[model samples]
Target: MKIAFYGSSLVSAYWNGAATYYRGLLRSLAEKGYEITFYEPDVYDRQKYRDMEPPDWCKVVVYEGTIDALKAAARQAAEADIVVKASGVGFQDDRLLEEVLGNASPRALKIFWDVDAPATLAELKSDPDHPLRQALFKIDLVLTYGGGDPVVNAYRSVGAAECVPIYNALDPQTHHPVPEDSRFAADLGFLGNRLPDREARVEHFFLDPASRLPGRRFLLGGSGWQDKPMSSNVNYIGHVPTRDHNAFNVTPMAVLNISRASMAENGFSPATRVFEAAGAGACLITDHWEGIELFLKPDEEILVARDGQDVAALIAGLSRQSAARIGARARMRVLADHTYAHRAREVDEIFRARLGARMEAAK
Candidate 1:
């Protein structure tokens, strides 16, 4: 099967958090004999900060930041067996959405893959005529990286023919344990791009803890926090590239996963960092949210923190041996049940079933 995926930068994780998810899922899909052409616009300085060169597993089309270029890409993409217009393309997403749905082949399976389903759902709910809401009935399927039953039900309520949550998973080859780097050594480290929805949570869960525990080093790695005030003990390493993620994960004594406001509220929305941290054998301390046990067992494979105080307490009590034990268990759990290869099989089955049903209806 040929899949044309329209998304943010697949080659850059600079300001795009979905890059790893796309890379993991599409790489696994390619291994399953699917030919994928990922179309990403050269906007948001992502092209300048690209962490990866185009890989052989799939074709990557870095189109210019112009409506004409995007339209041309859409026309080319429509010829594929499956056409995906993912959320948050960082350009004229409204136009791209319309182009994909309007120009895609009649026989092609059109999909809206929402990486941030909660925010998208909120937009749809707030506006009766949101572009996605208006187009939902026409889309063959809606796929989300997170948000379990709530997202599925919401999509169905909005006239989606079908909805599925694939969830985030680890690519062991890309994210597994690595030799710890000295520079990233910290008591608790967090890596996430600074966004408005998540900044307060980061402050509450990550920064507050750093402030309270003045002696403990809290490492923050991501873009857009260079100017953000932080405690003297807190280390702000701006824009850690994709290649350094493994070191950043392994070197930390414990890694923190703080959800965005919408994702935490919606529940069942684990950011890619959760799995990435776990895969690297980093003891993960995550803010409380629903449905975490469905992925990682709390207090065993992962530690759940309710607030900054809880995070501080967890870090204070965590010994190197304990952190290693928890991290090892987390890695083992993901390796057994949450690898991208497993996710790829699930996606393949869903795609095949949908195609089978369509063929039957046509016959």
Candidate 2:
């Protein structure tokens, strides 16, 4: 099958948290013998800032021009067996949504894949006419990163014709254990963009614990974090590229997973870091969130913290051997049930089912 997907930068993780997610899903799809053409806007010098080059699995097309003038690309997208418009395309997502929907082939399975399901559903509650909100029922399927009843019900209430949760999963080939790099070595490590929804959680779960252990070296990576004041024990390695994720994960004695407020509250919304940290064989300590046990067995495969005090206690008591055991178990869990190959198969089944239904309706 041929697919056309338009999303955030596939080459750069800079300011684009969805880059890893896109890569994992697309790579898996291509491995399944599907032809894919990925479209990304040439904004923010993403091509120049890219840390990884596009793989041979599919074609990468970068477009530069107004949304209206980009209709020619939409025409090409219409020819694919499936066309996807992922959430947060960096800019002009509303216009792109309208154009892509308008140009979709009558027989193609056109989908709106919402990577940030919580934020989208929450906003739709307040503004029903939120561009994409109006197009939900018209789209053949709505794929999401968040799972569980809360996320599913929210999408249904918003008039989504059908919704499926394709949660984040590990790409073992890209994220497996690697030799630690001294530049990233630390007692604690965290990589994430500094957004309003997550900054407070980072303070509560990561920074506060770092402060409690004044002698322990803590390393923070990712952009938009330099503006914040940090503790003396904390080290800031600004904007570690995607290529260094394995080294970054392994270099830390243990890595932290702090979920954004919306994702945490909704449950079953594991961020890309959770799997990446474990896939690299790094012990993980995450904040308390509902439905976490479904993914990782806390106190066994992983550790959970309620607050800064809990995090400090866990850090103080965890032994090297225990940490290594936990990391190993977590990695084993993801390798068996939570890889891109697993999720890609699920997506393929959903696409076939949706396409069949569309065919029936046409007949």
Candidate 3:
């Protein structure tokens, strides 16, 4: 099966969270005998911050961010078995959706893969001028990275013929335990970019904990956090490479996972970091979310923090042996049930089911 993706910069991981997800998913799919092509609008700066070079597993085409380039992408999509347009393409080229729907072959299944389901739904609900609303019905299927049953039903209500959640998964090879590095080694570490909607949660969950534990070392990584005033005990490592993630995860006594506004609002949405941290055998302390137990068994495989005080207490109280035990359990669970290979198989099943339904309808 030939599958093509139209989405944000897959070739760039600098300030690009979705790129890590895409690379892992597509790479796993490629390993499963699916021919894959990724179409990304060449945002020139990406060349400088490229993390993983285009692997031999798939063909990657970078086009100029223009109507002409989108037209070219549509032409390329015409030959694929499946063409997926993902959210957060980072450019204002809504016309690409039109060209893909208009140009793809009959056998080609067009999918709108929403990485940010809650944000997309909220925007569509509030903004009548949203360009993607009209295009939703035209796509053959809608797939989301997160958001549970409610999100799928809502997408169907908005005219998606089918909606599926292909939640985030770990890439075991890329994110496994590593020896600690002094630079990243911390009592607690939080790695996420700053967003206004998430600022309050970060303060309540992360910052407050750091302040409470004045003697313990805390670390903050990711972009847009340079200017944020952190306590003196908090170390700020701006934008660690995806390759360095495993070491970063393993170095910490416990890693922190904080959801954005959309993810927090839409429960069951575990970010890629959660799985990545688990894969690295890192004890993870995440802010409370419903359905977290469905992924990682709370209090057994992972720790949950309801607020900053909870975070501080967990860090201060847990012995190293206890932290290691939880981390090991979490890593085992994810490796068995939540790896990229598992996700690729799930996607393959979804594709087969869609095709089978189409065949049955025709007959």
Candidate 4:
């Protein structure tokens, strides 16, 4: 099968959180005999901060950030067996969505892949005239980053023919246990780009916990927050590149995962960092969410915290021995069940079923 995936960026993770997810899933899909072409617009300085060269698994088309260029890209993708427009492409997403669905071959399966389903659902609910809401009926399927039943139900309510949640999973080859570096050594570490909806939650789950545990060293790495006030015990390392993520995860005694407000409220939305940290055998302490057990067992493979107080207590009581044990268990659990290869198989099944049904109908 040929897949045309329009997304944020494949070569850069600079400001794009979905980069790893795309790489993992698509690489696995390519291994399954799918010819994939990823189309990313040359915007948001992503081309300037490219972390990776185009890989052999898929062809990358870095189009100019203009309407005419985008339309040409869309037309180029029209003949694929599956056409996917992912959310937050950092350009004229509305036009791209319309172009992909409008120009796609009648036999092609059109998909809207929402990386942030909770946030997208909130937009649709508040604004009846949202472009996605208006176009739902035309979409063959809605694939979510992960929101479990709530996200699926919400999309169905808005008229999606089918909705499925593809949760984040580890790409073991890309993320695995590595030797710890002193630079990232800390009691707890967190890496997430600052955004409006998640800043307050970061303060609650990360910043405040650092203040409460002043004796313990804390590390923070992300794009923004250079000016953000923090306790004297906190070490701020702005924008740790993708290459250093393994060291950042392994060196820290425990790594924290803070969900954006909408994701926490919606539940079942685990940030990519959660799996990355776990893949590196880093003990992960995450905020309370409904589906923690579905991925990792809390209080065993993972630790759950309700607020800053819980975070402080979890860190306070955690010993090096226990942290290592939890991390090892977490890594084992993900290796057994939540690798990208596992996710790719699920998606391949869906594609096969749909394509087979279409073939039967044609006969």
Which tens-of-lDDT digit does each residue in 188-212 have in candidate 4?
9999999999899999999999999
Output the better candidate (1/3) by TM-score: 1
What is the RMSD of candidate 2?
A: 1.3
- lDDT for each candidate structure: 0.92, 0.87, 0.87, 0.94
> For each predicted model, how many residue pairs clash, with residues at least 3 apart or on different chains?
0, 0, 0, 0
* Estimated TM-score for each candidate: 0.98, 0.97, 0.96, 0.99
When 1 and 3 are scored with lDDT, the better candidate is: 1
Judge candidate 1 at residue 75 and give its lDDT.
Answer: 89
Candidate 2 stretches greater than 4 Å from native? 360-363
User: lDDT per residue, candidate 1, 48-111, as tens digits?
Assistant: 9888899899899999999999999988866798999999999999899999888888888999
Top-lDDT structure, candidate number: 4
Where model 1 places Cα greater than 4 Å from the true spot, the runs are: none
For residues 103-189, write the lDDT of model 2, one tens digit per residue.
Answer: 888788989999999998988999978988888877988889866778888898989887888989899988999888999978778
**What TM-score should be assigned to candidate 3?**
0.96
Compute the lDDT of residue 333 as modeled in candidate 3: 100
CA shift of 176, model 4, Å: 0.1
